[model samples]
Target: MSLNESCGVYGIYVEDGEALPYLYWGLLAQNHRGHQSHGFAALSDGIRLYRELGMIPALSGEELKTLMESLPGRLGIGNVRYTTSGSVDRESLRRNAMPVLERGSRRSIALSFNGNIVNMGELRSSLGLPEGLSDAHALNRLLLRALEEESSIQEAVKLCMDQVEGAYSTVCLIDDGTLLAFRDPLGIKPLCHGCGEGIKAFSSESVGLDINGLDYCGEVSPGELLWIEEGSLHRERVRHSGRRAFCAFEFAYFARPDSLFNDRYVYEARVQFGMNLAERFDDIASRCDIVISLPETANDAAYGFHIASGLPWEMATRRHRYVTQRAFISKAEERELILSRKVNILGRKIRGKRLAVIDDSIVRGDTTRSVVRRLRAAGAREIHLFITYPQIIGPCFYGIDMATYGELIGAWRTPEEIAEEIGADSVNYQPIDDYVKATGLSRDELCLGCVTRRYPTPMADEMAREMWERLRSSEREGGRIYEG
Candidate 1:
């Protein structure tokens, strides 16, 4: 259950003046999407990029002044990366931190991408590709070639839509002062467009738009290309696979609770998840004395559980505000210590109680096991783990950090086995269909590849099968299966 967020993409187009402020706050607001690295490419007379190997810095003091002075432009693209693709060594992460900028003799464009390229291996062979180049770089190279061969940005993007496969929600800036945004034909990652008094922007999540005071327009649709020039927005349905496999994981885990998906707030969906659990597992509910949530992501669901089960929703777990980093993305040895420092238990309330612990999802099982260990030490009588999302039995190749079958606890073991492994009295997971219903989207509209192993795109489907087989045989497969 190694849960990891994909990435964040943001762009702003203004008539003239500094665009760095929007890019600054936009990235800051959605920093939860990625924290390993952050960068932005501004399109002035030429593209100017400022990127680093850690979180986006606070928007104040000399950092803000220096950032604004360094990258000044009317149109720009920004990204925060979580390393779903390419190497994670500091050198590789530093080299691959994007908006992956490509400067060519004919022309150039800066792109900030938010998804993985499933057909990367096949795509690379066609071009004289650079070793260790990231998916964003690969996609940018493909787009540059298409632009050289085609007549317009629209045509170039259409070619990209046809050739590139897998999850991608991209925002780019052309040298001609135009802002272009498009989602992969499947819309596997979330991206939305918004407009304010005199500004138009694209963001990975609506919270970014909200923070910047931009009115939410709508999502950049699957297979849709949004071209904005001067204040006009033009939309072209580039290619429709007719199957929109929006990543369902966003609602359950990654996306900010304030963000909207399919016009429904993510927090509301999470609340529904708790209600569903209470109704579906009444026996467990009746036995529990209180509902406790770990971190903030599970709080809404825990509250809903309290209402439905007639139990107290105890705010016993408190998170340290300064400890903003997630344990799943940190180093293995540091993860346990970070988790310990991040959360604290109010032992008086937890002691001598049958507690129902609600969580977003159990990815690698370490987080759950650690929390359970803390509760045990606090003298809890029994800890029943109620997971909001269904067990993820397969790996995610789209954009999440969970890329291999061997890393997923559910892939190798059942819920009962997971309960014993995590030291919980019982581990209850939501049914896939019920989880889908709670999101207010049909099964066809969401990508359930990690949960059901039925990937939306062709290449990912093939790769998952190959990886699953290799893992089944206990092969020593190192590195990401999708990357090869």
Candidate 2:
């Protein structure tokens, strides 16, 4: 599966009016969080919505001008989607795109959301919506139903949370003035709020706030609800006891280097992960002639590895940075395989050398195999692969799309077998104990569900079994694994 997180959300409550320009800047800052689709809805006298299934830059200069001319509101919500839990078909794309509208009690509510709702199937069945309605669509319908029966929008959200499960950090625009924002009990997804002059803003990452010159006011507390209207902001704590299981992958691979999460800097956290990985793998560090990192994700860890192991580092691989598009993730496997050739190796560095290649982790091992083969072709004598994280033996159910164990390379094969399969002299993974300690957070503070089979929440055994079966089927179809 693709290695993208969920969606990114941004909202603005403008008191002096005309907020589209600020919204545009905020979405641009968060563009890296997702590039598949772009959407926005503004509320003035009524809700106005615009959306398209492509990158922010794909909106032509004329289209942007037309949108700016047509957009009629001071308050707006915007979303950039990567699409984790749902399909990418046209109907799914159209229906699930956010800033979704639901009319209620003579006023309409425009809602935009990030993160997944794990118990969405149960909620859909309870609401009696179409069986195939996606998680986002199900959530929109459920919120409407709750608003119909409840006294206020805040009360409706609380009631809705009682039935909903999994990670969600959302923003809802009520009529032309009010904005509502809340996070999940565990705060698995990041959401922060800021204010400046007569305007208030909220986003999935603080980088948006930084780009717009808004003052940071801290994250939306786990299960805390906030209401912004008429230049005043009110806060209420909803659910308080759920353990915080923030996805560790956020620091390891997903979030932008410039963003801040849960009061900690993301880039710093990654550097710490690399430092800890170095400590764990120090014994084997001196055996290689050179240390090279897999581009992007492993760069930080490779730095840490160098510092801890006293090894010099070099950039051995080159990446094509211009290929950002929806087609990259949604295309057929053969096309993706061809696109994989975009990564190139520097022949002089690997030629006749004993090289240690450090990477974040191996998901399906297809990319790792390709990389190893390319390095061998470049005249490498010995290739030893070191991964910063532990072997991924299970799927992630909370929000990540790695929801099936069968797709994992480590799930069915031994490390030695993986080494032989990839033409590596040896493969060493960072120990799980060291991995957890490196974060400086306890087990309760992070989600290890993807690395281990123990889910934080209690999912039904049968449901878990069915998910595993589907995972195996996908692996078989993709030819991603060799069964023992």
Candidate 3:
């Protein structure tokens, strides 16, 4: 299913006149995380922030040269973002694009951040910020307030961590040209740092590191604060908790397949998901004539399914390379167009065949329903869906696009009901136990918040409960409850 990706946060600390290259490539590599707007804040003399709407388009030689000339700095933070909160209008897009720079009386901060803030309403009121502001804005204001009052950056970060709740993996630029990066107390988002020669960088995903040829350093620990000053870096275990809740959806959908999380590439974990599905449904696997996968994310898993079931994996569906609009964040009209028009089914492989189709997840039921209809038209006798991720039964508040119970088809429907609605003969999902094993993380280590309805952060859990009540009574129609 289509789901909006988390924003990508990138930062660089390097020699004078050297930050642009890393910033440019880092955001470019992970542009899939966000395509609506992109920008960077560089501290050349003071912080210089520039942002533009739409995806980072292809550039010729002259365009690249001109962009580089405009942004000059030794260290900086950058972000490519899509709205999970706040306004969605054009003017708001420009106003809210990161890196968000804020200044107080004695201290200032420019930050590029990922993850959602669950206490946004209270945070906005406490900061006395205007309504409908983005989570990043509210967070930047809160952080700026802390930086102004606290003597040390670490202390300020700790205070900020204590105040804000939910997922946040951030990279910030300080006034003195120092760079700091940190993760939320529960680590609901991914961030990692690595150094190469004279350059040190942090990114929301490892694909950014791979693009810059940086060494593969591990994930930033939960609640750890890391800073780079004068090219020398120091680390502090700012906050510690017995539970860690990294977003499990990252392996299932949001993160790039090449990204390394918990030492295993996301693609590898997805492949294991396929193997696990095959094992669980060996009876169904035996009846399938061929296995096919939805193009893109589920390709590796389909390959694994083929290996496990010993069935030929047919390339039955082909995606339109030019259709790049993601279904989750697109307007309803645009989403249907993209989902239906973006892929075509090969009649030869599908006609008169019993098929086991592998896909990532079933969210709103639109994308899958459309695909099933296409396959039916192609003469498939029976369709069985093998989904990589477990069924998402609850709304996701930690930056995933799904934040409303009404929008989630799996929220109240049983597997049989979902299959009937989506035109699948059977719908099979990997057991949550095996899904956890594939990530190389224990069940308690990952944020199964959406699937299990147990949130790591207190505020998100409380707000989710309130929203659930509203949703049940049909009192709330749309939008995130935390956004209230």
Candidate 4:
């Protein structure tokens, strides 16, 4: 059984005007989050949903018009997804595509969600849901169950919040034209609300709202529910765990740089991450001749390193403009080919230079190794890696694809060992404290489970402990424990 996936979700409720256009642009802006599939759900007389494998296509004028005509509604939600959950085959990808719609005897509902459910097995047993259901399906079923038992949407959501475990940022569209959005008590994923003329919207990232000309309202607070009906938006604090465990990976890699959290742009935080790296690795900085990033995500950090270290930041590697999919999110079998075609190295510029190469993170070392080989072939005399995120030492019970100890290159190796394994002179990961400081968020407020091996949720923490013990022994670490 495949687990869950990290995805991007967008929902809009407009008092006037159609919601499809705004939802389209909103999801499009967040295409970087997931590339495997794109989908949309609109609420007209009833919910109309269209989902397909692959990114949202660049529609021609006529095609856009046809899409608009097909899904006419004043409220809608959209999703872009990549699988860490379910099967990755074409058939499964089509089956798992969202926004996921569930029909019941009394009412039907549509949902678009990000993050995983840690206690899915228990939930399934308790709710009597069958196996082979995607996390989104399980969640929707759980909500439907709650809705059947409760008197109001708020009460149902509160009950679900009390029962469900793990990271989830969700948006729901009820058949009665009600639009609802909520985050888990821990706020382990990103979800925010925005407003515009006669419109209220919810997106997994602030950049989504930015693209749609919406005013930045605020985050849908941890455990808070926001619903819109009869042209009015209502807020309710369903449950608060008295703490926040926002995913730190968002700032390190997943989110678009322009995304905002706590009034600070992710780009600015990444730049600060570079400065922190420079300060921490001054010795390495002194020895390096030039700095170059591993294309787009690391570009900001590379610039920050140059700014602080007085080194020249070289644009020695250029990403293919048309190759927009992220290698980190791609399947392992396809990653090497994608990276080879996605980035081009300017060999002449770095033919003899000792380069400080910046990157977001080194997951399995395939991407880093491939890039290092290309750099060596391009005549880079020396390569030193500066990683923005700390070393990932365990599986992520949330939504990240780093699922097993054996899959993570840094899980059993030190920085020096990893450097040797990846063909680099050195590997410098941003320190935990420095990373938190750079993000402008407190240490207790961020989730560092993948790096620290200390999860915020109870089940995840226990699962990691058991997985670690299995990995240490000769026992075969089976599939994702969450699925187990």
Candidate 5:
């Protein structure tokens, strides 16, 4: 099976100095979003692109100077890629890495994007584009095609928004030093714009802007298009879809803790998630001797659990600082090995103790089961799992990795069954309504498709409905439904 990836995108336009440095820092701030590959495209001479298959390397002062000299430009865009819609093999990943530069009939452009296209087959067939184009490449082609036919760049973005059928938050560096940014009609992904000094930038999350000391300008509203060139900024609402569907999974599992969403920090919302869990499962909280987090992402939530339940929060599961790879995003075959080396268990703290373990979410049962086995071996007397995100009963067509019903444990098993399979005392998922409340966004503003089995976009909804119907009676299902 081809694995899926969630990615990060960054673009910057500097009126005086080179923009590559700013672009580099922005992508680095959000590298957690995508770990497989990194690339950059700068509009100097033409569109100079540099791509590699791995995380963005930490550069020394001399290395940074060399990179700046190689791709020096006042306008640049970069991406840390995770494949939501392409092959995951080494060659395929290398070939499909973003800052995907393409030449159209009239002009050349390089783009970095986050999110998936639901109607890729239809788009490819209708446009007569080639096979094997990743969703980002397909989007670049779509934009280039529109640019050829439309009178202005804004019109081209409008045309792409009107035709495309899934989430896309994109930043493009045109060959002529123009910086273009836009979000999908429904705003199913996170994209924001900020500025500092003579620098205007766009990123997948606010933490990128924060790292560069840029002031938070605001989000690129749903259906909005931004065109920047020669120190000027132009904005237009390209299409009004009458709703917003920002990916809810971002608040629960993906974004950095310091990242801002709807003016509130992600860690703040996760804390509320833990508090809600405590209220909902007070009996279980009463029985637990201590609260233990699954390291890194769940640390804040575990603190809230400790606060509400009055249980001591133990920093028992310490993540190895050097083991930077995320087990959740690694390929299936590599996930186990990464998880094993990811964290060390403090056997004395949890030994013979009824521990309440807090985690972000569980998609497939493998990672959770592995953690449970580790805890059991370390003498954990009891393990009750408190998960932040609601149960994922359906595949995500927007941009998440869980693409088939057969791969999602919640699609077929009850919480009690999941507990038994993972060898946990109990498994408690955050209630859907409580999760929505914690994010501070109304139900209409967030995409709960994976949890509720209802997608915000029409094509994704139709495909999911049909796929679920067919898979309901089958013993197993394989491959991404949208791709098929």
Candidate 6:
């Protein structure tokens, strides 16, 4: 399916010196987060920016050097956008590209955003914009309009939040020296701050900070605004909407293992998830001979699964770590073939074994089907598929683009049917209660809307109907259905 959420973002404010190289490295470290586009803006005497809708490594040696050298500022912001809300069509693609630059009353603002905004339609209608306005454009317009009346950039951001709703963790460069950063009231997306030398940086993942040798300050709290100028940072809690709901997917499937979320390590969380899964399936532990993980997102949970079950674990599938671009699988048939090619089965490890495969989640049955087929082909006596997350029975209305109910395999098929389709001896998913508990956060602090469809933000009936119609048309057009 066409994956919707983008990965990570990085921004820096360095003393009057070249910051593009640092921004480039930051983006490089975050390259896994987004491969579709890369861009950076620097402000020295004026705003100098460079961006292209392609992978970072795709830039020719000379092209890379030219963009790096041309960037003119000590203060800069960079974004790597993965299309989540819009289509990949040419017009939609261009509209979703980020570090959206705009000229404001006080100065120029180059905004780089990471998360999806759910209320774009309502916001557009309220702003009196055209019906066809994309979320990126609508957001840019809202930010600009807020700036028109507010005193400072931070105030403008707070005022803008009142108009739009949904998950957003954003960074904006205002004028040549000032930087503004904010996370949504729910803080469903991650945004963190770090300091290095005379440089201060903000990123969606802490790995960006570690790559740049920056000291982690802490995460930017929800409903807060940060302003950075001349290597110094100031913070103001503009809106005190204490309600916070961090996206659980960030820990389960999105953030880098080494990254930290809300002061908790992602790798640790996965280990905890595995521990919880082990306890839930304690009786099945002795029936499995070995535990194997579907790398690399499932590696941590697999590790946890192994430790909890006391099962001897081996790497049955080898992954080519360098493949960074999104694997485009157009059809279900093609998806199965591509998945098989992506992982190589170690016959010696799987032969004559009763294996347990630990995976992050089953968005669709294609990838899991391929993996199970390869394992059984290698003489695996039996295979049990364990998903770290519960069945995703509904679409995510917040930001994640999970397919509609009709397309979700879990929505129509039972566990037995899923097991049969995937050719597994049995299929088990983490219970929703256990999954929520594993995060060590309250229910209200997490968004389980993808699994339950009880969206935090109200989804109007008309919008839901429109989305359903779109899904139906997409099915007719033979587009990849985004089941979770």
Candidate 1 lDDT, tens digit per residue, 273-357?
A: 9999988999988999999998788999998889889998899999988888888766656778889999989999999999999
RMSD of each: 3.3, 3.9, 3.4, 2.5, 2.5, 4.2
| Model 1 lDDT-worst window of ten | 475-484
C-alpha positional error of residue 6 in candidate 6 after TM-score superposition, expressed in Å: 2.2
User: Each candidate: how many clashes?
Assistant: 5, 0, 0, 1, 1, 2
lDDT string for model 3 (50-128, tens) is 7998766777778867776687788988998887544578987787888888888876788888988877767778888
Q: Enumerate residue pairs that collide in model 1.
A: 1-362, 1-363, 1-364, 2-363, 2-364
The whole-model C-alpha lDDT of candidate 6 against the native structure comes to 0.75
Task: Estimate every model's Cα lDDT from 0 to 1.
Answer: 0.86, 0.74, 0.85, 0.89, 0.88, 0.75
What is the per-residue lDDT of model 5 for residues 98-194, given as tens digits with 9 covering 90 to 100? 9898897668999988888888887778777666667677789888888878889988998888888888899998887689999999898899999
Predictions ranked by lDDT, top down?
A: 4, 5, 1, 3, 6, 2
Q: How accurate is candidate 2 locally (lDDT)?
A: 0.74
Q: How many clashing pairs in candidate 1?
A: 5
Between candidates 2 and 5, name the one with more favorable TM-score: 5
lDDT over C-alpha atoms for residue 446 of model 6: 82
- Cα displacement (Å) at residue 434, model 1: 1.2
If scored against the real structure, what TM-score would every candidate get? 0.95, 0.89, 0.95, 0.96, 0.96, 0.89
